[model samples]
Target: MHILVVDDESVIREGLARILEGDSFTVDAAKNGHAAIELLQQKQFDLIITDLKMPGMSGFEVLNAVKILQPDTPVIMITGFATVETAVEAMKNGTVDYIVKPFTPEQILEKVHLALEQKKSTVEDIVVKKEIDCHHGFDEFVGESREMQKVYRRIIQVAATDSTVLITGESGTGKEVAARAIHKHSSRRDQPFVAVDCTALAENLLESELFGHVKGSFTGAMQTKMGLLMVADGGTLFLDEVSNISLSTQAKLLRVLQERQVTPIGGTQPVSFNIHLVAATNRSLKAMVAEGKFREDLFFRLNIIPLELPPLRERKGDIPLLIRHFMNKFVEEVGKDVRGISPDAMHFLENYSYPGNVRELVNTIERAVVLCEGDVIQKENLELGEAAEVCSTGFDGFVPTNAEALKEMKRHIRDRSVENVEKAFVIQALKRNNWNISRAAEETGMLRPNFQTMLKRLGISVKDYFGR
Candidate 1:
């Protein structure tokens, strides 16, 4: 870690710098707080060790300035008159730690280590919290896609309202996850988020599961049981694959949505419940209604505000993010010290269609992380099974050097014949993918609309390339 040492005393500064250097830390020294601030402006440091009694700018002033400038970096204060009140005031002024003067080198280093550790922990916490806030509850929802942005905005807008929501998307598009997010972000976040796969259980069990049942209601009913709806009262009920629910069950559910009550099996009294209903289906509900497989009125009841999660192919830009997220999760689960994925591995990940959507991508990364032995995950570590050759993106097994990076940047800037940067990026992606638009789009993590724009800008004709 980079450490900045600030003190007016040359002897103290030189002594501390020697100790820190011995500990293998990169050190920057300044005789006063003003010099320290100037050095900080030019470069980033992980921790700042400043003497509280500096002449030009006092340690308190420096701490306040750093708090405003780079709050993530921590500052530790050194004081000769180490009073409880002074230490507390220094802490309140944003000093991560306060050390007494005449401290051993070990004591100072220990405090610096603690400060850096806290800073790292704080950064990780912020990242996870931001993800949870963005996704509501599930971290599976990954996107910077314009369509996904609209979906996120809609979710936030409708979360506070107790409207019945219908989530529609392809099978692997994370509809159930979206349902949970709505519930988590809603007023009833503390209550249960009950999910029932409408197609998994038999009709009789499904009805009993949702509406509850009294003792001796059915052949196997030995005890009174609360159904999913009542359990989810004050929260949300997610009905997955809602189109598959039997017509009879649909009618019963529609009544619950309409009247906010559930009648236990073979019971006369209808128990009142307050719940937000969220239903999801891969099939087109409108088509199902026309085909008499789904109830039109029930569809109307659930379709008050719809949220459709885009397919993986539509938001391929999130693959890198999803890969990193899954890698971190797997590292925690498996207790591994793997550093990162190889460039070729990332290329392969970016190109695949991921027909199973984000779930498929996550599973793929998790599997790679678990099977890999080395510090970095490589292309050979992944067992894609049938997905191996589906990538359109190129893999050159290149690890970038500073000279290569500079050359690539200069080449990129000069390539006006290839179109603007976005288009050129797509063309470079196509070159990587062997000129396959579909694969190039996947590799570049561009959705079809954005990919199409990329190709048009690059003077590429899909018809000419694919003979479509």
Candidate 2:
């Protein structure tokens, strides 16, 4: 584990570093609190030892900063002029322990060991509780529908073994949550669970991130760095939006999977890792492979065990359960006194189809909870968006007697479906091009004027997606 030592005195800082280093701990020492805070921002430390009295930015100030930055990390305060009042004040300010200066190395080591052990126990307890909750029919999921039950079963079946899992679903269908569930139930639950978003980084940066690079490997490579695969060694690595990975990276990933080893960008030495791989994507790898966008070999490797999540529309019976779950969650989080949803609000929520799936429902509920004034949430409190407003009009009791009327009804349904699909396509194109209309049009093989016309017809505002 990594530990940081902060002291204005060089002698105290060096002495603490020697003691911690001798105990097999990676240590970084800072002469003052300002330098210590800078290191904290750059790297993560499991424990921090700071002297109470400093020239500026005292240990108490450092503790406050850490509470805002890394709240979970334990801090130990050391002072030469230690008193009962000072010790009590340190404990009140969130320091795990207080140590008097001129202390023996044994005392410091014992305190460090105790603090780390306590932190480990607290983390493991939380993990164990979550695992237990999930074991009882997947607590993360709210539905009791057969579709979700099947998903739970598949997760349990594949989690026991170290098999590559590919989760396919639409956006906001809780793909990452499923990946976490798999990792939590697996034997490597105690190890690190690293998650990476493939779509967030450029191709070159992503390649460097996945495979470590030695010093002077590339233009910006100033020092050797360990890749995420090595960081997740003996644990799980979740790759979200894996389909966005470029073909060249796919080939390299396939080799890593086939050989169970990774070679750094400039280093010839190969480092081996044992990680349970879980990949998720909203897009279809099969179609991408057929279109020559994704490698078929890598697809097969990742698809050893496949799990598909059902969209909210497909399992509408679970909407009420989900609404209540989200309502209780947001009410507590927002510290609102909302006790229930009105009948009209619940009806609108249950009937409205969430194109964005569970994530949309979550946002809707949180908004209502914040806007709600009374004990119960009203229909006005729920903002279902423009799409929901358009789709809310359904022919509930309309019985068409003539063939013409029935044909008109069918035509209306078809038009609405087409409109939804067209809007989704246009939005996706704009997103891929970072809201650049000209580039989006060119990529989609459409004239700029035609793309703008379509955007206007679909009521899509470029400004809405620009900065956001």
Query: Over 4 Å off in model 2, which ranges?
Result: 1-137, 393-468
- Our model 2 lands, by Cα RMSD against the true structure, at 21.6
- Lowest summed-lDDT stretch of 10 residues in model 1? 390-399
lDDT of 2 by residue, 107-169 (tens): 999999999999999899989965664433374777766678789889889889999999999
**Against the correct fold, how does model 1 do in TM-score?**
0.57
Looking at model 1, the pairs that clash are 392-433, 394-432
Evaluated against the true structure, the overall lDDT of model 2 is 0.85
* Candidate topping lDDT: 2
Output the worst ten-in-a-row residue range by lDDT, candidate 2.
390-399
RMSD of each candidate? 16.1, 21.6
